[model samples]
Target chain A: MEIIKTSNLKKSYMLGNVEVKALNGVDTSIEQGEFVAIMGPSGCGKSTFLNLTGMLDTPTSGEIYLEGKDVTNMNSNMRAEYRLKYMGFVFQFFNLFNELTVMENVMFPMMLNKRSNYKERAKELLNLVGLGDRLNHLPSELSGGQQQRVTIARSLANDPKILLADEPTGNLDTASSIEIIELFRKLNQEQGQTIVMVTHSPEIGGMTDRIIHFRDGTIEH
Target chain B: MSSVFFYARKDAKKNWKMFVFVIMAIAISTANIIIINGFMDGLTDGFLEKTMDTSSGHINIYPNEQDKYIEGLGIKEKKLDGLDGVVAYSPRITAGGTLHYKEKFKTIKILALDPSKENEVTILLSKIDSGKTLAANDRDGILISYRLADDLKVKIGDEATIVFENGKIRVFKIRGILHTGLAMDTNTIIINFEDASEQLNLFNKASIILVKLQDGTLSGQYKNKISGELGIQKIKEWEQEIESVLSSFKTFRDISNFMNAIGLFTGAVSVGIVLYINILHRRRQIGILKAIGMKDSQVLFVYILQAVFLGIIGILIGDALGYAGTKYLEAHPFPDPTLGSLGPRFHLSLIYDASLVTMLIIILAAAIPALMASRTNIIKAIWGE
Candidate 1:
């Protein structure tokens, strides 16, 4: 079943007098349990597409359907609610709250949603990401790989249907990148988790169930 | 809800410098307000007490045709009947007089008081340092204030010649010395009304009638009744009688009050600016919150709660410091040149009522910035260049 879909999506930005079309006429869809990788060079609208699909950006002109519900023109508050319940994002920079402990960071989404059993669920997610021992430590005290693992734990806190990762291993070393890619494969294969990841590494891109290439906004499947 | 509070607490902890600045601003402003109000309250209370104790008997009576000082203005003794709230009435005759005590001469105000009635009007005579109260027939006996006695170099039982209106003179023995701790005391001498009536040749008439009202009764009604009975067109209330003194006190009080208000306003502004900057700096965090599905109202509430917390701390600090400062002032009073005339010391009561008002102001001031910070655009905050 298709869990994420976008139709004729276009995004433009005005840099002084010049209009830069970040995403132009892009149509794509990913299935419920698919581990998909979207590969592109720098400034090739890959991040823009991921942001739009993750509900972080509203396309200038397009339609987005999360689990068959059109969410193109939802208000900011409604969009936030939709994102909380159905979507999770992992930024290239990990983006863990620096002030919060690893356990607290993982529990952030559930806390915002007023979820019961936040502690148990956060503990479960931290253990799943192999950071159970580091739960009490702040993000600043953790290694880059450890922080990325915590970010992944936080993304799973809300039990989101589709995890959208924009360059999840972009800031990590070879071993951390392979470990993160293996985690994504495990989440998809063993747990039936659906993921849409954007990455530049061809080696990482080949490990996904399907690869979607982009040169200038539109996908080359 | 709890999440917002948790985050707000985290944020405040992370930014202790800003928090300290806000607290300090609020404390200083609150202290300024409290001290100024304390002084005003003390001065007004002191002035009013002294004036009531020394001169005006809380109420006064005079003829309807006589408004200002007149030669022969007195309420008839029979007119004292049918007055509901009258505690006592003292017939008084006031006239300028020149005194001679062994050639150390000085012009002074002479109050010809009915000795028995005068005791009911002023508490000063009862507090005499030496000698006894003059009898009704003691035409040769007089009471003088301690400061006046010192200036004239007169001792108890010493005779001083007093020259009244129309160059009429009478020699009276100073039987007592009164220290009322009021300006009027030093320049005033008290004599029996009988002697004054005989000397001034106004057998039954007096210059003024002092009426003491029953405690807790409204003097306004008594004043009207006295005016009606005496057919006096203008009877001055105690507040009006000391208008000059009251106005001066009021002016000083208002200036201090204005300064205190400004301090409070500035304290609020400081808190606001600090919180505003804090919000600006933490825009990314707010965006993260919004992205995590926190409602706009929720975000706004968190910041407001933080501001309220800061305001409370400020007000508490201010109240403590203000109270301590006022207490110190009370213990160590200012060297007042008017002390001899007014009193030895002036003290202020640190009122909780004013502090409550100041707390409300500081809280409101802090809350405004917090609310504004919360209501900012989350998307712009998150994704802006």
Candidate 2:
């Protein structure tokens, strides 16, 4: 069954007198537990599409269905509730709260969710991400690859159904990038964690189950 | 709510300097309002006590309807003296006169009364700096204030000649020196009533009657009662008689109120600016929190909790400092040359009310920033706008 489906999705925004079409007439579906890569050059709407799927942005037209439920017109608060329950995001910058320790950063979403077992779950996720020894370390004290690992751990805190990564390893070195890719591959293979990643790297795209290429605002199949 | 509290505590702990600065600013403002008000209260209370104890009794009776004397001055005085709650009553002949010592002449307010009888209602004998108060039989003996003595360069045993309104010159020996602790008494001289009546040639005439009440008697109630019974329209309570001093007291209160308003406004603005800056700086963090599925209300709760926590601590510290400062001043009062030996007093109720007001002001100051933070566009804030 398709976990997320979008039909003829379009998004337009204004920049001065120019209207930029970030996405146009995009029809797509991702089945459950699939590791997919959205590959495109800059300004091709890859991140915008990922954001719309993550409910971080709304499409100008068309419908978004999660498990056959249309959520295209959901308000910001309802979208947030859906994201909390079913979506996790990893940004290029890691986006870990600099002031919170690794353990606290991982537990933040769960705390907001008011999960009773958040602490134990955060600890387990940190250990799984190989950051168990650095639970108390702040993000600033961590290496680039370690910070990405902490971010991944944080993303998995709420046991989200889909992990939406926007250039998760874009800021890391080659070796760190490889390590992060391998971690994502392992999570997909072992836990069947459905993943959608936006990346310019052919190597990262090649590792995914399938790649959807984009040019201008439409998928190139 | 619990998560909000946790976040607020962590934030405050991490940024303790900001919290401490806000708290201290509020505390200082509260202390300023309390201390300034206390000083004004002390000055007013001291002036009232000195004025009342020296000349104006709690209630005074003058000639009714502009009459020079009550229809029966002796009879009215006796009736008031025998009334319930009447502590002491003295009938006095007050005349504007000129006192001459050697070649120097000075205008003076001269009061003629039996010093023994007047001392019962006023602080006469206790105010004497030297010599003795007038006895009933001491016809020519007079008591002069210390300021008058200094101005005239006269002392006890020096005789000063006073020319009354009737141009009758009478020489009376200065039997005692008075210090009334008030500036008005600087030119006051007291003489025996029999001598004054004889010299002024106004026999059986007294212009004013001063009445003291028993302790805890409300002066307003008795003033009205006595005025009605005596059919007099010129009676006044001590507060009414000392209108100028009371006006000065009101001026002091007005100034303190202005200062309090300024202090409170400063506290509000300080907290408001600090919170606004904090939200501006933390916009990215707020956006990220929102993107991570934290509700706007939750984020607002964290910020509001942080502010209220700091505000409450500030108010507590302010109240403590205000109370301590007031107590210290009460014990070791700041001396003023104008009101000698009077100390400033601050009521506990004043501190409590001021603290509550400060808390409310700070919370309101913090809310504007919290609302701004909550309403921020998550996408723009995250993108560093």
Candidate 3:
């Protein structure tokens, strides 16, 4: 049931003739329907690994298999198609489009994927996130936690098999953080969603079914 | 396509300030181009009409002149007797003369024409303002311009003495006043060729032959046939007679075109800056779009769609404003002393070709910025340093 797997992944960056290895020789796998948390200190390649796994960036040298289909060398347009059809992401900063209303923000991913029933699906997702009454409110009017909930709703719009969360609670208060975690738990336990989240908080990391801790560029456990 | 349209509408609504600014810039530039072109068209048409009315017939026939003094009196006359498309043929004697009325005298050019056939050569005589047209039996009657009558203190039926080159004197009565809306009217006089022949002492001679062809006939073929029959080396057409005037019009058109190009360039710059700022401000939105699996082309389409929206607004406004301005100018005309005694009136009619060219220029101005906006890179546009 290995839904996502990477073998000997390596990533590097060039800064003024000096090379920086962000992720070096990492191998990992996550089973289907598992809520997994990746834990690491700052600059420990957690975001890099998430980006690679989410298909936002390609590893320098590695093999990435999603549902047993190798996606390591996909072109830009092909990768975009794959991302639209099979994956969704929640960012650390709650990167909601300010110009769009809360409902419109949630509807963005579906619109991008050209879903025919985008409006109805968006309303349903907003209701599920408990923000149906605030559909017309813009992102700027929403609090950090509300915005994160809207982002979560948007991630589900395409019915993606794999949902990637990069510090989803990074910018929320304690109460908002707990509410968001409970929502994730509901989505994972009830709806059997497969989620891979990156977090610095041990408390949030502990709530996941499995935790992968990392230091520098290597997994510690 | 529907999704892109929806997003574009939202984006334009969100950035209404930039949108309005771009539209206004386009509109103003387009309006300027239209108004200038219209004005030029009006002026050129007015000049051409006056020239045709006062001087040259639609077609003129003259002897080929290899030398400067291909004497006007030496013109040969042939019987165009049974030509199917020939309308009217009038022979004329042209010479510069001086008229003396009271104590004042002024030099003028006289066209000694057959009184019965003169209307075929110059149509403006039919629009005479005072007295009667010259009759075939009237040997000593002359038709003088209204402005010349005013300058000479002469009225209809008053006698004016004209002095020909050989010191021959002929005292002629002013039979009528010709008022053409043109400058040449003030310096022209019409007299019967018999009296002109008696005064100048040139018998059975004419300076030029004018032929008014039937409407819709091929003037070129007729002109060539006439040239071949007459064995003349040079045959001048209506267009050739006004070569200098047409050249001036072409020069003005080129200047207007250059001005329109500059205006469009500036408009494009304004739109470009507006779009650049818009893209910079919406960088995060673009990033979010890309993260949501939107391709670069899709993101670029949104910006291009926005630019097109702005261009359409601009062109519409510009065309309206230009049309209104031109109409206003047409309705209110300034006095032109060159239009003789008929008084000045608004010149409105423009050449259709010029108007079409101006419209094309305006459209091109609006489209360049939109196309440029469509080529912007989504990732770089979004991820600014």
- Top model by TM-score, which number? 2
Q: Order the candidates by lDDT, highest first — what do you get?
A: 2, 1, 3
lDDT of 1 by residue, B1-385 (tens): 8888887787777887779988888888777777777777766767777777768876666544633343344335666745766778787888888888997987888888877777777665675667786676787898887778889989998999998966998798998887665676677888888888788787667777787777624777767777777766656666667776687677777787788778878887887788888888877777667666677777777777777677777778987888888778767767664443221222333436545666677567667666666566544665554
Which residue pairs show backbone clashes in model 3?
B182-B339
Worst 10 residues of 1 chain B by lDDT: B340-349
- Better-scoring candidate (TM-score), 1 or 2: 2
- The digit string of per-residue lDDT tens for model 2 on B1-385 reads 6666767777777778876788898888888777777777777878877788777888888886757765677767777867899888888888889999998879998888877778888875577778887787898788887788888999899988999978999898999987767775679888888888888876777888888899524888998888877778888888787888888778779988999989988988888888788888888888878888877788788888887888788888888888888879889986665566766787887687787888888788888898898887876787674
Candidate 3 yields a Cα-based lDDT of 0.77
For all the candidates, what are their Cα RMSDs to the real structure? 4.4, 3.4, 4.6
lDDT of 3 by residue, A167-198 (tens): 99999998999898888899999888899999
Model 3, range B238-353, lDDT digits (tens) per residue? 77777767787798779877887787767777777777777667676676676678776676677677767777777778777777777776677656655432212223332233
TM-scores, each model vs. reference = 0.82, 0.87, 0.82
Model 3 misses residue B169 by how many Å? 7.6
Model 3 misses residue B248 by how many Å?
A: 1.8
For each candidate, the DockQ is 0.49, 0.52, 0.48
Candidate 1, residues A1-221, lDDT tens digits: the string is 98888999999989999999999989998899999999988888888888888777789998998889899999877888888888887877777777789999988889888998999999999999898899899999988998999989898899889898989999999999999999989999998999999999999999999988887888875
RMSD of 3: 4.6
Where model 3 places Cα greater than 4 Å from the true spot, the runs are A58-63, B65-78, B95-110, B126-192, B195-207, B224-244, B339-384
Native interface contact recovery, model 1: 0.49
